[model samples]
Target: MMITMMKSYRGKLHLPMLAGVVCALAFLVLLYNERISFLSSTSFMRFNTCAARRAARDATDGGRAKIDDMEEEDKLEYDADICDITEGRWVYNRSIKPLYSDRSCPYLDRQVSCVKNGRPDSDYRYWQWQPDECSLPRFDPNRALRKLKGKRMLFVGDSLQRGQWQSFVCLVESIIPKDQKSMKRGRVHSVFRAKEYNATIEFYWAPFLVESNSDIRIVGDPRKRILKVDSIAKHAKNWLGVDFLLFNTYVWWMSGLKINSLWGSFANGEEGYEELDAPVAYRLGLKTWANWVDSTIDPNKTRVFFTTMSPTHMRPVEWNNKDGIKCSNETRPVKKRGHWGSGSDKRIMKVVGEVIGKMKVPITLLNVTQLSEYRVDAHTKVYTETGGKLLTDEQKADPLHHADCIHWCLPGVPDTWNQIFLAHL
Candidate 1:
């Protein structure tokens, strides 16, 4: 059609007609290109805007997730502050593994290392402390070391406190290199130092928490445990400037129904001694210790904690086991809540409360007594020593008179005490 039109117009082709045809085609082509360029620019702007918005939204969501995690941790810490952790029950969870084994910790005393001494069963190590309202965080050894950096945590009391010290050392030292740690097992003031942290976890042998005849690291006579109910100068000198002081004096104070109390020097040949009822002597002794704490301890420098009386499972009949003797052959915890055995004196704990209650400086009490009463299975139970020596074959055969039910096994109840302790810190 264009060829026929062009042939008819070829002879009559005029300059104005040719110019008008060319101009019309040029106008149409320019308009089409301009429309395509406008659509392309619009599409690019829309894509760029959506992509930038999506990236910003993703960043905001990530930040919110991180903030939520931090808030949860803060909530846990708050709950721990409000709840009574001492009111917990012992949950026998089989999945529980000890923080450190007796074999792994060379710092363990021969007495409390029941696993290494052939206790035969490991069921006692399985009981976990579950609080009624809040759960304790799993203990972190590295964090404990950081918390105790450049500090001295001194455990002052009898052998039971010594056991707790041992458990704490094992917990933190498991992560420490051998070259960075040292143990000084002195007769009176034993020390375990982590050189990297410049921190020491020590035990000062103050059985009565005052001057006592049994303060002799190894006593010649076990029957003559006497307390000079008004003396603290000698022991308090060692306790000065300690950062964390954990004081306990229950089992050692329980010698008999009556204890010998003295008013003068032990060098005076027993001339100033009088027999007082055990509770009376205990109260007098604590008064002396509390006076020392009130006067000598600068609360700004030292944090004081008193562990409640750790119970003893001597007679199984109290737990309704007529066939058993001492804590021997026990493989499980006491099922009853608030179970108090015949061995643990509630009167002694009352004295502790009254003394600490009247103190001038603040002293937090780690009330692990009731929870510990449920753990009859955790005692050394004849796998321990009587006088710093492992029990003989003859002593092992007689579980009634030889089993050391007073001290709990390592990686056992004392670990839980340390757990509650870390929660406070």
Candidate 2:
């Protein structure tokens, strides 16, 4: 009986199953070895790579510092200290007194009297985004700039929104070395974090910041729609626990009207267009945003800011005696209007201001639109990278829109935008 059982076990009947089990075991072992190798190799590679990059940057910086008569040496030290403060170290500067004289209004710009119907007084002496200073308020950068390190600041909006984000990054990075600065692109947001400042600033590309056609998805049937608010929520979570939240969304509504996307129910269960217009959509969106702010965001440690709609450059006819052209060759500052004057875009501004002002949460308004509209020539459409080179004919054929008509050239309008942001901080 034992000899017969041994013969059966060794038969072809069980050979395939036994071979399969052996192969499965081998695969798992191979997978484990590969994972271990990858983990160990990457760890070693990163350690050596970082050391090499640091050594290279230091050697190059030493020569540049010597050539510049060592001016950057002192600047570097001050910057490092400021960067350290971002890690929550409060550096008190005795020489810098309270930015405001009036206890009623803690901002110095608020005290100064300015022309009626103009930009805020706070913006004039500092950023000068608007002409008059009546409504302008300022933030003392000296007080708040270094206070944020390891904190997150987010700006949510369209292309014009990028101007503010870029400006903020440039200003902070200027104080810190480029080597210490790092940028990582996220699915919905792009993040720039400075190790020195221990600060993370991110911008989410939510032009509408509401449930719109841009965000919704249509299945096999175009008519069948789903509101994927969770898509926005994914990035919204990053806004959580953030020390400073700067939110702005407007330029995407440049169609002179907002697109209403119907998902399940319409207002009062009624469907169709005559019911909702651009302003209605905008108001509704802001209401949703405010609700999110009220629920998810905590105000005690988090400072919330909403930058007003930035002005769009549509016609060259009104820009300082120009005609029939866009902002192609514009370089000089607006000699005709200072700040956002009478000619500034009002239709969008009114809606934004009204919606934001009515919110239960107090959101700081960085009124940059009026002042920014004047710097049309500062845009970088007609040219190439950093506006260093002009656009070729081949580039014009693409549907990417004229580079000049949209995004502002870096180091130009954005620099002042940061100055404005810093002033407010």
Candidate 3:
């Protein structure tokens, strides 16, 4: 009976030992599975990070990469055909240097050559336009001049358009020999010719696009501006047979809710002006221009571009400056995203869009207003000269009096504008 009792005790001990072994095996299995899961998750996260970086590079590099290699989550859906390149943000890139400098390009107007004329800051010259989907090719003056060989290009409208024209001149002139190019200014027009290429780039001063009292070579007063809304032939006659035409008219149209439109010519002695709602008057003026293009221009031969209004940075409140502070002394662009300053008129853009939409002729709209709105620091501001005269002490003290926030600095924002324009061409 003692032997039987010992056997039972041993059996009981053996049962507990077997249970402990089973528990240890189960714990090992659980740990192994957890480690496998962790490794799989880490591998997936690494792959996703690499894919995201690749996608971003492809998006900015002109969308040349194929999407087949990308996973569903990594694929970027974009149609280059429908994408608007002008609609994008300005990214800080150290790689992109200015295409031209104020000192290098002799053709730059003094008013727009802010850096060459002794502006202190150099940061504005470095910022580049980063389109949302694709990259804009850098401005190659030789290629542009080659493309324009035997062609004539004209920029029509206000001083803002003149700024763009000057930008184009400087861009193209850099590649040409000094002796082969010539620049001449007439009463109402300025011409820059690449003699060997037989190409001409011209600017005509027509603030209203139609004949107006403000059409004089020198506009004295902003308030005294008057438009003949229905007539654009006086200016359109000068635009005929141009290989490429760029046009802009906006700041002059923003005079008031009602524009003083004259029914008769400015040369007539009789002075009677009727008030027309600004938008209505704008539409009328655009329609006249559209009619002129439709009736005269051969879409197959001529490429027309209407650069949307260039934004102005005159208002201090828009950029959170003091009441008296304008765009002067601004050293950098507005860093905020989607910054639509009060300077650009959306109503005017809508009018332009509606008018262009109805036209039978093909007119490409260089929608540059939004891109330019962020470049508040790129204007001529107080560091500019007009008519080759330095700013007097009085004008320098009063920044508001001599400050020009309308025209952009050459080798600055306008170079990017030409880049986009050339991309389309």
lDDT-wise, the better of 1 and 2 is 1
Lowest lDDT sum, 10 consecutive residues, model 2, at 80-89
lDDT tens digits, residue span 1-425, model 1 = 00001112446854334443554455455445431111011111111222222233235466343211222222223132234454446777888688899899999988888878888898888888776434567778998999999999999988899989999999999899999999999889999999999999999988888887778744545457667899989888999889999999887667677788888788667666888888888899999999999988888899898887899888889999999988897889887766887777867877876776678787777778778888989998888877668899998999988887888999899998888788777
Model 1 regions lying over 4 Å from their true place: 1-81, 220-223
Worst 10 residues of 1 by lDDT: 37-46
Q: Is candidate 1 or candidate 3 better by lDDT?
A: 1
Pick by TM-score: which candidate is best? 1
Task: Work out how many backbone clashes candidate 1 has.
Answer: 0
Per-residue CA lDDT of model 3 for 62-176, tens digit only, reads 6786422323333223222233444456766767777677888877777877776677887888888765434456788888988899999999998889888988888778778
Off by over 4 Å in 3: 1-80, 217-219, 266-268, 322-324, 386-388
What is candidate 2's lDDT per residue for 1-425, written digit by digit as tens? 00001112443544323443444455455445431111011111111222222233235556342211322222221111011111111112235332322222211111111111111222222223321101122233333447676677887776566666755664455455668778886546788877877777777776667554453231333233222222345446656777777777765554544344443443553344333455665666676777788777777777787766666565666665454356554545554533343324466667666665566665666655645666655554444432333445665433145544556544345555554455455
Candidate no. 2 TM-score:
0.57
Checking candidate 1 for backbone clashes, the offending pairs are none
Candidate 3 clashing pairs, residues 3+ apart or interchain: none
